[model samples]
Target: MADTALPGTRVKVPFAGQAVDGFVLARIAESEHPGRLQPLRRAVSAEPVLAPEIAELVGDVAARYAGTRSDVLRLAVPARHATTEKADSVPAGTVPPPDLAAWSTYEGSAALAGLAAGESPRLVWTVGPGDDGIELLADAAVATASAGRGALVCLPDVRDVARLDKALVQRLGKGRHVVLTADAGPAKRYAAFLAVARGAVRIVIGTRAAAFAPVHDLGLVAIWDDGDDLYAEPRAPYPHTREVLLLRAQRAETAVLLAAHARSVEAEYLVRSAWATSVALPRDEVRRRAAVSVTGDSDLDLARDPRARSSRLPKEVFEVLREALTVGPVLVQTPRAGYATRLACESCRTPASCPACHGPLRIGAAQAPPSCTWCGTVATGWSCPECGGRGLRAPVLGDRRTAEELGRAFPSIPVQTSSAERIIDRVRARPGIVVATPGAEPPAEGGYAAVVLLDTWLLLARSDLRAEEEALRRWLNAAALVGSTADRPGRVVAVGDPARGSLQALVRWDPAGFAQREIAERQEAHLPPASRVATLTGPAELLEGALAVLQLPAGAEVLGPVEVGDGSEEQRYVVRVPRTAGAQLSAALVALQASRSARKEQHLRVDVDPVTLG
Candidate 1:
């Protein structure tokens, strides 16, 4: 059995009198057990799915996130497909040298050259407005492939993967690249995985899980829009895609590109720490391309139009939208997606709540009955708990509601809606209005004539630490889709307080500056990126037990055992440590988890550097 099943080989072994599937990590010359070891049940396959480098990455990620190795392996590898594994390997195609002219506009074009020459260059790239970031990534992959090395590009979702897939096909031709997304189904996903493992394809692109693609002789790992919440794994350990790719890059000495329209504090930290180089267009170039303005930026302007503060669409916003619609499609970005996501009493101004579960009530459609946002319980004849008034009013307007209003205002023009329920990938570059929620804004053929950001205050009002940063990111993502030129700069109008730092940043097209300021503020507050944080959530006694056993590193601070969830049994504890002591903190938490596991104790969920702390 030892001779037949080598390290990384899949095998079935006897565990507690039951046959369980497992992977061989290593072979030892002798066994330390006092009793004779049980014989192997059978070998599942001869193919070693877990490549050595990928196995090392799994271990590193597990240690970093304080999770078990098996859990990380589940994310790094795909389930086996017997027929796919037994099929003939596809031959690699010749990749033509990539056109680097597109990268010449940025100062970091040298990094791409270095990558093509087998040099590792870490870069934090800020894509310019109206630029096809997918094409840029494909160019990098082509450069890597031309040098006989592999490249991996991880996108936030299937939409992005599809865009990149199309770009790669146009550049690298067929069979030169493979996409590994869960949407491809089990058989096709397994086949794509096998193709990479067998060295059939040197270029790979997919969503989050593709960060672990075993591309042979890897030279580049590029991640797009790392700030998107989709990049954060919801399962145990909750490893973020950006962190995972950084770990892989460090271990394999591969070039890594973190590209996005808006900068994240984590990515900014990479540049500040000298771990990566910043790549962005010149300020003059940015000014020449993006024409942005904020409503209520000046007292004089607000005094001229007093209703701008209370009205959803101010007079100035309407003028901009009206003029832009004559030339091309106009994008109207709303914060929410439904008809009315939140409701309140009309007479008393008290929030409406579901009587069944005490959750906030919402309306999903026009004139629809109120329903609980939490449990989906319909509320009939519901009255406000704080007041006797039964009438309800919508204070927040979602995409659907905004679309309905815009359709009436512009009765002659067409109004399209995009949200989670229905997404429009692309619209014609004709005159129309496209109403969409954040992250759901579809691109136009050439580009939108203008983008109107509605309800900016709703995003800034979130009870989360990254609220401001997230708001800027969403705004920038939408604004970047507008077309621009030196003679006719793209227009972006944001309805919010002009003095707000995020709004000011959007007006100036300075995401990097905003991120720098954000990092400085976080440093003063001792928040993430400046320090390390871990959250432990479970039952009260379980959390207390885990905290007591943890050998916390010096300078570590434990913030809470705060009550959470629907009942008192559950609690949450926040542990923080200086950046220098992050490894020690992770190690201690890992030991605590191991101790609990050995004693058959209930495990607590652990999330390190979580996206939010609400």
Candidate 2:
């Protein structure tokens, strides 16, 4: 690393979703980015900042995300702790695992063995409710350590860290490893960073930011769920943690494992590209544990009204919930977080529109007039834009709505609702109507008596390209929270159309197979996995000129001029490319960087895997 602690030079200061002006801290002798590079304006960390190899990882992630390098570094290093101890002068040798018996006997035993062999780290994807051997994953650091390598376990949140930390402490002994996360406060987190930096603590477990942990002789990098939006670090140079892990593993020649119950298309791409292999349990094991029933099956989509919810909580769901509650605690999963997620006209099925501008109406503050989320124009008498109709419906349901219905249906039982406002432990401790937003599900007390997968259509209804993959992830996370011991598996039921690809994966408990099929679609459409994609939407006039000037190399394909929104809006244009053509396309985009005309008239969103591509 150079003496980046230098005096003066324009430095790109990294911030969340924004950039700021700053100057260089110093220069380096041998830095990662040798060109277009300046020193740090000031020391963000009191200790050794992000490690050089980790920086390399960040660089790779930035390249893939098409984001700025500084922003990637910020995601990689959320904070720096105060432990400034230089690494110890220990000689090279193997360290015995504290819990060898448990390590050798973990679930996904075959997959764990692949990891133990130091295979280039690959993400391990799975489905069902979450709490399966998280501690065992944390403990793998001990096994990898015994094999003379360092391991870094990056989790999504503090709750996960605490959950996994307890497992590590109980099984491997407390203080045997180090825990790192942003919530730990600067001083403590920094101390943990240095502990690993100096080799005092070899096994490093932390939240998203810990992807930058500096551990020499690194061997494995594992991310729980590669699809969670939380892992995407919402910053200027937004980079996904999974991408960073893949890059870090490659540069360090370390093993990578992405662990999740449901597999993502990206994870499947790794397997298809020979970057990683799939690690899963037997079909019968998962089936016998949890008998899944998908509503909307042609055979049986019995709505209580028999009319079908199409997207709402069908009446039959209430029946299932009633029975499941009698057996034990039940979970109801919804798409939105708040009390009322949407506002619709009663006369027409179309979404309500603003009077001033023909934009969709949003719900919030009953006193406030209905306004367009897109144009922010106050709407007059509620009406639908497509048909001067007076009715609109929230195709997607919210946790509050689901909870309200459950409370009415199951009047005798104690009911609880968990959203962003309520903490995880509160929901985890309940036994009643545990209505939760996707990914917000708390650990179930006695494993959910039944987990009603509501609003399955909202996930499928998204307009992004990877909609199916993302929905499956949300479904799987809810399922993971509803698991039981080997003797008895939990019961999980879906309340919407199970005819979609997501249900196929959930019902059969075959995420890998589902992902394989989805990737094939993307590949056939010349989309992600097979091809890199970018989405741009705004105004028609501006997009017209932008599209005319954009250039691509021989291998790249620019397929859109396709408009988003309604036909009248003409607000979308999509770009497609083979993965190998990224550099050329990236350079072209840099050259055609939105001109004044384009910026003023239309907006552009550069997304690699648009989760909704409807």
lDDT of each: 0.89, 0.66
Taking the tens digit of each residue's C-alpha lDDT, what string does model 1 give over 40-159? 899888888889898999999999999988899888898888888888769777677888888888877787677777788999999988887888898888998888899999999999
In angstroms, how far off is 302's CA in candidate 2? Answer: 4.7
Kindly report which residue stretches of model 1 are placed more than 4 angstroms away from their true locations once superposed. 28-37, 296-298, 354-361, 367-391, 566-568
* TM-score of each candidate structure, all chains considered together: 0.95, 0.76
User: Residue-wise lDDT of candidate 2 within 568-603, one digit each (tens)?
Assistant: 665666677778887666666645553533456444
Backbone clash count for every predicted candidate, in the order shown? 0, 55
Q: Stretches of candidate 2 above 4 Å error?
A: 1-50, 62-71, 74-108, 114-133, 173-176, 179-186, 296-316, 343-397, 426-431, 485-488, 534-551, 560-575, 583-614
Which structure among the candidates has the greatest lDDT? 1
